[model samples]
Target: MAYDSAHGFSCDCGQTEWQVSKTAKGSQVVCYCTDCQAHLRHLDRVDLLHDGGTYIYQTTPDAVTLIKGHENLALQRLGPNGMMRYYTSCCKTPVANTLSKATLPFVGLPLKGEDPRLGPVICHAHTDKGTSGRKQTGFAAAGWGILIRAARAILSGRRASPFFTDAGEPVIHPTVLTREERRIASLRR
Candidate 1:
């Protein structure tokens, strides 16, 4: 539950592996935004959803390090301006979401269970957009935390993101979904 220790994660097929360092700033949350749901649906990975939401650890980019299978990493977006979504082409496992530019220093790592190391869900974001019927709370706190960490990351000049190059470019090009694909994925089941 503490970021004071390292945590590792991998794709379903184990082809891609990554780790978050002990000193990384992060928070856990269950996000139920339509965009998040649509992303999973687009990948045919609805199985990753729990109670109509995805559990994620929101952290700074400098915190992550790709351990292996970098070649298998792929990128996508719901639309031209959507967040960059990373996944493993080997098995279509959702990896993380980040701003189009790595300089922003944020990554939302999709997780499976309530791994105690992630600490706790600091927020239930966009609950109104989900079918779980849960009330939304703590979003403000989470937002503040993210902003604070982001500022700190920027100030510290920590730019060693696994998802980006030293020059602040994405590790791979992104594929933007078509309008039709987005519509279909956004449809409520």
Candidate 2:
């Protein structure tokens, strides 16, 4: 499908800006996973969290376009095998999360607030890890949507990633957090 519209988002310092194509095939979800929470805490961006979860638009990396301040973009991981979390060094705004490799073609952009353009939340993931006391929903639909989007992205050649190079390497090297850092970030408030 062709991109129909674009929604812009920027870091707290407004130094890093990007847009997500509306046509991106994926799901809008509120992820309450501990890792998600820890990521925000690691960046000292707990203000981005809502109801003990992070609102994320899970889509293909090809759908994201960096508008400016690419130099401020930074990558980090909670551990050696954790998903790469992208943020802006200028203001510590948690931007997106992705698989270890660009070939995976997935990007989960954390939303500061709900955007009607991305549609409604289709899933409430990892509620068991949430402090909100809400039940998980729409797991099956979200799972199928992810599989379908991933399959289509792979078939389409996984091009145009804002965070990765044409050679499938990250545009910037990732910093793996120390165990102490992870422990501190994971501490309950």
Model 2: residues >4 Å from true position, as ranges? 1-4
Residues 76-131 of candidate 1 have per-residue lDDT tens digits of 99999999999999999989899988767789999975668878789999998877
Give the deviation of candidate 2 from the true structure as CA RMSD: 2.6
- Please provide, for model 2 over 110-179, each residue's C-alpha lDDT reduced to its tens digit, 9 standing for 90 to 100: 9886767788999999999887798999888887887788889888776678888778788899999899
Which 10 residues in a row give candidate 1 its minimum summed lDDT?
Answer: 1-10
Which has the greatest lDDT?
A: 1
Clashes of each: 1, 0
Instruction: Report the error of model 2 at residue 143, Å.
Output: 2.0
Candidate 1 ranges beyond 4 A from true positions? 1-5
* Candidate 2, residue 57: lDDT: 91
TM-scores for every predicted model: 0.94, 0.93
Candidate 2 clashing pairs, residues 3+ apart or interchain: none
lDDT of 2 at 162: 83
